[model samples]
Target: MLTIGTKAPLFAAESTKGRIDLQTLIGKKKLVLIFYPGDETPICTKQLCAIRDRYSDLEAADAVVIGINPADLTSHQAFSGKFGYDFPLIADEDQAIRKAYKVGKILGFLFQQRIVYVIDKQGTIVYAKKGNPPVTELLQVVNQNP
Candidate 1:
């Protein structure tokens, strides 16, 4: 897990919204990177839907939300369309981003762990937590930096 104040690992990948370059987003918007195991699963769906439901709050804080999963672009597109999510869902097909963040599975599990990282405008990681962190907590963090 990446500690607070550490520089976030930069990545550029295809997403539902378009090509996303983490470096470009830095110094522009506070970012919330949602790393999950797969698309359309129960927990992952719930977690993303929660973000969808409160997306405006995230935007109000001048934050950009991006979800990363090992699923392909087609899967991510389908899932995002089904949920009407406006944010980008990145397809980490080769798991490079997952490996970069050290968000691999527990024990011998095949899926990545559910992790959330909040990065500030300067490319510094402000928060890193495993599992589904509350939307309120994330909003508070975003609002604080804005």
Candidate 2:
């Protein structure tokens, strides 16, 4: 996992909202980057759904929440539509973003490890954790860093 206070690796990838370059949002918004295993899976869905439930709070804190996985755009679209998630879901089809972040695999490479990173407005990571963390905890980190 990327450590706290490290500069986030920048990347441009196709998302549900089209192409997004992390560098562009560096000074504009704090980032909540959720790296999950797959789309519409049990735990992944629950994790993203939690974020969706509190998305307004995240927005109010001046954050841009993005979910990433190796799932393609079509899979992402269907998942997002089914869940009514307003945030962009990146289709890391080639796993380039995952590799850049050093997110490892689990269960003999069957799935990517779930990780979450909170990047402040200046593009430095403020929080990095494994598994599903509560949204309140994320909000707390964002509020503290800001």
Candidate 3:
């Protein structure tokens, strides 16, 4: 697992919006990178929907939320469309980003664990936790760091 206070590993990848370059995003706003197991699963759907529903709050705090999954672009497109999510859902098809972030498979299972990394404007990781953290808590982290 990545520890707090460390520099976030930068990457460029395809998202629902287009190619996202983490380096460029670093100095722009607080970043919330959500790594989930897969798309369309019950828990995954709920987790994403919660973020989608509270997206305005995230924006209010000057935070950008990006979800990463191993699923392909087609699956990501369908999932984001179904949920009406406005944020970018990145497709980590080769799992390189997942491994770099240290969100590896869970308990020998095929899917990665649900992990969230909150990075500040300087690219320092301020919060790193497992499972679905409350939207309020994430906003608090972003506001505090700023």
Question: Highest TM-score: which candidate?
Answer: 2
Please name the candidate that would achieve the greatest lDDT relative to the true structure: 2
* TM-score for each of the candidates: 0.97, 0.98, 0.97
lDDT of 2 by residue, 10-119 (tens): 99999998898998999999999999999989999999999999999999999999999998899999999999999999998889899989999998998889999999
Whole-model lDDT values for every prediction: 0.94, 0.94, 0.93
Would you list the rank order by TM-score, best first? 2, 3, 1
**How many Å off is the CA of 95 in candidate 3?**
0.7
Query: Where is model 3 more than 4 Å wrong at Cα?
Result: none
lDDT pick, better of 1 and 2:
2
lDDT head-to-head 1 vs 3, winner: 1
- lDDT (C-alpha) at residue 20 in model 3: 95
Rank order (by lDDT, best first): 2, 1, 3
Give the winner by lDDT: 2 or 3: 2
